[model samples]
Target: MNKTVNQKAWFLVLPVLILVGFSAVIPLMTVVNYSVQDTFGNNVFFWAGLDWFRDMLESERMWNALGRQLVFSGIILAIEVPLGIFVALNMPKKGFWASFCLVLMSLPLLIPWNVVGTIWQIFGRVDIGLLGYVLAKLGVNYNYTQNVIDAWATVIVMDVWHWTSLVALLAYAGLQSIPDAYYQAAKIDQASRWKVFRFIELPKMAGVLMIAILLRFMDSFMIYTEPFVVTGGGPGNATTFLSIDLVKMALGQFDLGPAAAFSLMYFLVILLISWVFYTVMTNLDKRDGV
Candidate 1:
């Protein structure tokens, strides 16, 4: 006789399916509807076909925003990944100091994103902000609002300060998973610090590092509120990444069709990059028998 399958689990999953339908699928379908149609006013929609998508593809403004977004994400990954790995490697392996270090590393990650933005906005102000005041006192030109370089620097630094801790924490967890036997073997072999890291620690942390990269990349690529709160995509659109530009199109200019199309393309780019990363990671795992 055939064993009975647990068909009852569908009942348990039904609520989640309903919730997802309302929260994600419905809204996504609405966006798809808008993306292919244009509206004048009073809820009158005209079929625009692929016009909006074509316009977004050909628009220089969108391309420029895309370029800036890529650069910002690249800079974030470059700084945060290496810095996080370094911090993780140096963290205390055991005891009270380890606990203390872990707590310290976690503090930044716990702060609200908008609050982080607000804090940085004030903190970089030239008037009463300590950082700005000190920089000015030291004869440094530090003004995030008025200058492009200052705006970019402040945004980059703010992002680094806020998110580096996440990378460190993930990397630390990866480090914690390595058995002491590996370190002992390395020590017996008289492995230098670099060799231990290269041949042992790095390989062990590869899984988590991949995770860290993907997380940071996606977050940085979609970054909005922090930079918005801080720079407002100002100084001649120097910090106007894709999200800001999309918001501008949707709300600022009231170009709903273009905005919807832009959003869909944005979603696709993230999906594509994430898929690539996942595929590479899976292949690497298989190669290493992981």
Candidate 2:
């Protein structure tokens, strides 16, 4: 006899589907509409074909912003992935100190992005800020509002401080899932620390690390609020990533048509890159049997 399937449960999922349609699908449709058309005040819109897309494709400003975004994401991944793995390796596996350390590591991830920006903004001040004052006392010429390099450094350091904890936590969880039997076997074989880590732990942690990397890449690429509040995309647009540039176009300049087009392209880039990351990681997992 065949078992009965519950069709009524479908009704329960309908509310969530409706909510998503309103929240995401509807807004996406509006953006698509705006992207391919021109609008003036008084609710007037004219079909512009692909004019906005062509303009955005030719815009040097968009290209520069894309380069900066790529660089920023690259730097963050370079710093955070290795740093997180190292931190995870050293982190206590048990006891009160381990718990305390984990809690401390989590604090940064808990803070709001705007608040993180504000904290770093004040923290880097030349007068009242401890970091700025110390740097100034040491004769380091540091001014985020005036120097492009300093502004970039400030934003990079702030991001590192804020988000590295997330990588660490994910790595720690991956590390924890490795059974003690692996360590015992390694010890029985007289394996070196590096050998054990390379041959055993790293392979085990590969899946989670890929997930962490993908998440970090997406977040870093689309970062806006914190860097916006920190640098305001200034010191001559040194820290203006794509999202910041998109906002400047969409809201600051009120260039809706081009901004909408840019948004659509940006969404596609993120989606494409994330898809590549997932594919590569999945293949690696299959290869490593992890």
Candidate 3:
């Protein structure tokens, strides 16, 4: 005799489905509507076909912002990934110090994004901020407001300080999951530190490393508030990434049609990259017998 499956469990998820439809699907549909139409005041909208999309595709301003965003994300990944791994490796594996280190690493990740920006903004001031004051006192001529290089460095360092903890935490979790047997076998073989890390540790951490990479990539690409608060996209628009540009179009200039088009394209780029990362992660899991 075959046993019947209970289908009533489906009802349990209905409320969540309704909530997502209202929160996500409806808003996405509204954006789609705005993307293909032009609107004036008083809710009057005219069909513009793909005019806004074509215009966005051709806009040099958008292209420049895209270039800047790609550079920033690339820099962040290059610096954070290895640094996080190194930190995780050096952390105490067991004891009170391990718990203390974990807590310290988590503190940065817990701070609000806007607050991180504000803290950095005040902290980098050339005259009043400690960093700026020290640099000025040492006659380094540091001013993020006036110097493009200084502004870029400040933003990059701030991001590293704030988000490196996340990478460390993930890597630490990956490290914790490695069984003692692996270490014992390596030790029995008289394996060197580098060899053990290369053959044993790195391979085991691959899954979590990929996850950390994907999360960091998406977050860095879509970063807006922190950089916006710190720089205001100033110093001649040196730090204005795609998100800031989209906001300027949508709200600053009140160009809804183009802004919606820009946003959709932005979403597609992120979706495509995320798909690629997911594919890599799945393949890694298969190879690692995870």
Candidate 4:
């Protein structure tokens, strides 16, 4: 006799399916619909076909924003990964201080994105903000609102401050998962600190490091709220990324057709890059038997 498979699990997942349909699928369909059509007053729409997509692709504004976005993401990954690993390596493996450090690291991640932006915005003001005031008192010229380099530097530093803890916590968890026996074995071999880290600890942390890199890459690439709030894509668009450009096209300029097309392309670019990153990293992991 054949045993009947239980099907009740489908019912358990039905609510999530419905939620995703409403939250993601429906909105995506709407964007796709808008992308190929032009609308005038009173909701009259005409077929625009690929005109908007072509316009966006040829637009120098979009290309500039994409470049800036890539640079920002690259800088973030470079700084956060190494800094996070250093912090993790120094943390106490088993102690009350470990718990305290974990809590301290989590505090930054707990802050709302908009709030983080706001805090940085205020913190960078030259007339009143502590950082700007202190810098000015020391004869350093720092103004994010008006200077291109300052704006970029402020945004990068703010991002590092707000998100570095996430990387640290992930690395810390990976470090904690290594067995004490690995350390004992390394000690018996009279391994140097560098040798122990290179031969054992780094390998053990590979999986979590992969996760941290991916998460940070995606987040930094799509960053909007923080920079938008802090710099408002100011100083002659020096800090304007793709997301800000899209918002300006859609809401600031009210070019719905172009904005929709721009958004679709933006989504695809992000998806493609993220897929490539995942593929490369996973293959490396498999090669090393991670």
Q: List RMSD in Å for every model shown.
A: 1.5, 1.7, 1.7, 1.7
Q: At residue 243, what lDDT does model 3 achieve?
A: 98
Residue-wise lDDT of candidate 2 within 60-123, one digit each (tens)? 9999999999999999899999999999999999999899999999999999999999999999
lDDT of 2: 0.93
Q: Give stretches of model 2 more than 4 Å off.
A: 1-12
State the lDDT of candidate 3 residue by residue for 1-290, as single tens digits: 99889999899999999999999999998998999999887899999999999999999999999999999999999999999999999999999999999999999999999999999999999868999999999999889988999999999999999999999999999999999999999999999999999999998898899989999999999999999999988788899999999999999999999999999999999999999889987986787675
Off by over 4 Å in 4: 1-13
Instruction: Output the lDDT of residue 40, model 2.
Output: 86
Span of 10 residues, lowest total lDDT, candidate 3: 281-290
lDDT of 1 at 149: 93
- For residues 1-290, could you state the per-residue lDDT of candidate 4 as single tens digits? 99889999789999999999999999999999999999886899999999999998999999999999999999999999999999999998878998999999999999999999999999998989999889988999999999999999999999999999989999999999999999999999999999998989889898899899999988998899999999999888999998998898899988999999999999999899889988998898788774
The window of 10 residues in a row where model 4 has the poorest summed lDDT is 281-290
Deviation in Å, model 3, residue 147 alpha carbon: 1.2
Residue 184 lDDT (model 2): 98
- Per-candidate local distance difference test: 0.94, 0.93, 0.94, 0.93
Clashing pairs in 3: none
Question: What TM-score, over all chains together, does every model reach?
Answer: 0.96, 0.95, 0.95, 0.95
